[model samples]
Target: MRTSKHLIEQLASDLGYEYISDLHRPQLLPEIQILISSYDSQSYSLKEWKDAVQYITGSSCKLCECEEIKQYLLSLKNS
Candidate 1:
């Protein structure tokens, strides 16, 4: 079984995020919220969000370099 750490790294690579574990998940919201916002900026769309969560949870490995994923990690650095 792949460890969570390895899974996160795979997720980052697949999504084009240079680093996913560096940013701390905000305590104010559930970790899933970060995943959701990381994938959708304008509206509530669960496509990318669900894919990422499924990757992290060891359910699937569907990876894509969507604009939303790029912006999400970039926003973390900018902030």
Candidate 2:
């Protein structure tokens, strides 16, 4: 479950100015791609995966996506 280009664009838009320089590290995008891939696959245990998901998804948090992702993760764990 890799992140799509549209999701990256959405995250960039949500993050606004900081995304231009501060958040846009050379490896950030690629790292995020891997992060979400791991997240969707539940590649880590709940504790580890939650931390990773929080770190990655919470970084660009101008929108409600973070909360949504958290909810989804909780559901996955419960299910």
Candidate 3:
């Protein structure tokens, strides 16, 4: 099955993540907010956030995970 952005957005909503795809820099701060909300009520460190991006995007390098002009679909288990 093909997972389009809209499908991802619906999945994100169902998964408790705030979908915000229109970003040029992929701000860590806002992304952190989604991370915090998507997961359980907990504090998210920069390292954990980086790891989350890696896990979600399936990228080896952290840089590859953080795409500047692309909006990605992410899910956090027990978050």
On TM-score, the candidate that comes out on top is 2
Q: Residues 1-79, candidate 3: write the lDDT tens digits.
A: 2223332343345545575342223433355446334442123333444554554444533433223212332332322
| Residue pairs with backbone atoms closer than 3 Å in model 2 (clashes) | none
Q: Which ten residues in a row have the lowest lDDT in candidate 3?
A: 64-73
Ranking by lDDT: 1, 2, 3
Regions more than 4 Å wrong, model 2: 1-27, 35-43, 59-79
**Model 3, CA-based lDDT:** 0.38
Superposed on all Cα atoms, model 3 deviates from the true structure by an RMSD in Å of 11.8
- Of the pair 1 and 2, which is ahead by lDDT? 1
Q: Provide C-alpha RMSD values for all models, in order.
A: 11.3, 12.1, 11.8
Of the two candidates 1 and 2, the one with more favorable TM-score, higher being better, is 2
Q: Pairing residues by index, what is the TM-score of model 3? A: 0.27
Clashes of each: 0, 0, 2
Whole-model Cα lDDT of every candidate shown, in order: 0.42, 0.41, 0.38
Q: Once model 2 is optimally superposed onto the true structure by TM-score, how far is the C-alpha of residue 1 displaced, in angstroms?
A: 19
What ranges in model 3 sit over 4 Å off? 1-42, 60-79
**Against the hidden true structure, what lDDT does model 1 obtain?**
0.42
Residue 25, candidate 3: Cα error in Å is 23
Between prediction 2 and prediction 3, the one with superior lDDT is 2
**TM-score against native, each model:** 0.24, 0.28, 0.27
| Residue-level lDDT tens digits of model 1 in 10-68 | 44554456876532334312443345344333332335443544443434434344455
